[model samples]
Target: MESPTEKRPARRKDAEENRARIVAAARAVYASAGFDAPFDAIARHAGVGRATLYRNFPDRYALGAAIVEDDLCELEALAHEHGDRPDAFMKLLSAIVERHTETHALVPALLRGPGEHALQALVPRVTRLLTVPLQRARAAGLVRDDLTLADVIDVLAMLSAVLADDGSGRARDRRMARALELLIHGLVPRAPVGSPIGPNSPRM
Candidate 1:
């Protein structure tokens, strides 16, 4: 009989490959069709059987979480590596915004589903990734000191609307790029004025 230890490696390899395949297919399908894309469709797209997809990701949220976790990991690594650069925050934010454009609408909805716990756990990690570079940018005077992590997240959430699957990809990209530039500009510290005319402050 073959040794169990020898059998284990092959099994593990196949499992890892299947997981990668599922994630890739899920990314593409979710990008075009949103998170409501059928699980069976994703399994077929990955060229894996339904049982394999289930074995890897038990539900839609599980599948979505996998894609998100992978993206966050990459973003965190990029932020850590470029934390000291003056433009690091902008660079990282730009990359994240661009990537999110692909699946912006779907992510929020997926996280609100029954299996959201998996994604909820990842929120803090994504926050951590953004924090270091944001703080660094503030210290370097590239971003306003008043800016907070929540503000950054809120901006990203709002920007997601710009990338809604309307018109052509080129049109969407052009609009999104311009919107991102405007958002980045907002982060720059401005000379304070005595008047309280800012957004919600009311005119008096």
Candidate 2:
């Protein structure tokens, strides 16, 4: 069952801190275990009462969504730190891949829950953070001239597909790293060779 969200007032300072702690704890537990890690485990890790944990998050899906929201905030800060560098987009993309390595368990479970919409809603915000970096990259010929933000989004989606097949281990880490390297290589600026992709290009 969902928690009642009607007519709620602002949380107190301690309540806000508790909420943050819960989310951070949930993230760590998820990394060590998976999204199915018990709510009590998260509550204990957060050093909050079960009631406080439930008050802040109704379920694992809510925790997963909250984690994503927190991650996006971190990404916003990271992109700002990169600050118009031509390689900012690549750095941001690499950071995202690393995050997914730790958080892949959330994707399949969140997709099964109502929090999928919450994840979808953040796409626009993510795009906004990515826009400046992508623009800088294209301007500096760091990415292909024809690359669009949508294409980059698609690349991220493809990366998410890799999450489905991974087991949480050193192998998973290496696999994700290699996947990201391959994706970035494809995305890097290419020399114009008279439409080498079309029918006029050499076979094989």
Candidate 3:
């Protein structure tokens, strides 16, 4: 009974909602099975036919792009939330490691190249959030003076690779924490060992 113009908008809204649902279902499937997840399974989960799924996503790369966009948005929120703290660099690094461990599938796929442009677009915003805290940490002799923003990005990528290996999560996290501690220690200027100040203190 409605006019075609009014009905067109309603239909478009419905299509958008369906596409969102399909993307969500695809994300869940990928998280469980990575890139090997089948289109049929995703279609079943989305409650759509294979044809409908293809209509929405077109191919694996399209689905991957949608998921990566969601992930980058989440990462951006986290970066904003913790990027200004005195220990922002450490917190930011830890958060990245945790995500690498938990969200194993999405990271590598995004790192492959499809999401690089999106990440590049986000870099200025992310760098603005990180720069002052990182500079302060360097000034405090708490982070490496020679470290560039790109070095921090490389460290994150390496940590993600480490997490992707076939190790237990608990062991991997413990090792990553130790490695980060060592990296931090290496960055700082060490003072000579002073005399013990308390009974509980180790003998110098």
By TM-score, the best candidate is 1
Q: Which residue pairs in candidate 1 collide?
A: none
Q: In model 2, which regions exceed 4 Å deviation?
A: 1-11, 192-204
lDDT of 3 by residue, 6-90 (tens): 7998889978887888888887787677776898889998888888889888777677767656655666677678655656666
lDDT of each model, Cα atoms only?
Answer: 0.81, 0.85, 0.69
lDDT, residue 174, model 2: 82
**Candidate 1 lDDT tens digits, 96-125:** 987787667657777578657877888788
Question: How close to the true structure is residue 159 of candidate 2, measured as C-alpha lDDT?
Answer: 83
The number of the candidate with the highest lDDT is 2
User: Against the hidden true structure, what lDDT does model 1 obtain?
Assistant: 0.81
Better candidate by TM-score, 2 or 3:
2
Cα lDDT of model 2 by residue, 1-204, tens digit: 535553244346678899999998998999898777889999999999999999999888888999999888999999989887888988888888888778887877888889899898998999898998999998998888888998998988888887777777888888777787788777877646666666675331
Model 1: residues with Cα > 4 Å off, grouped in runs:
164-168, 191-204
Error of 2 at 152 (Å): 1.2
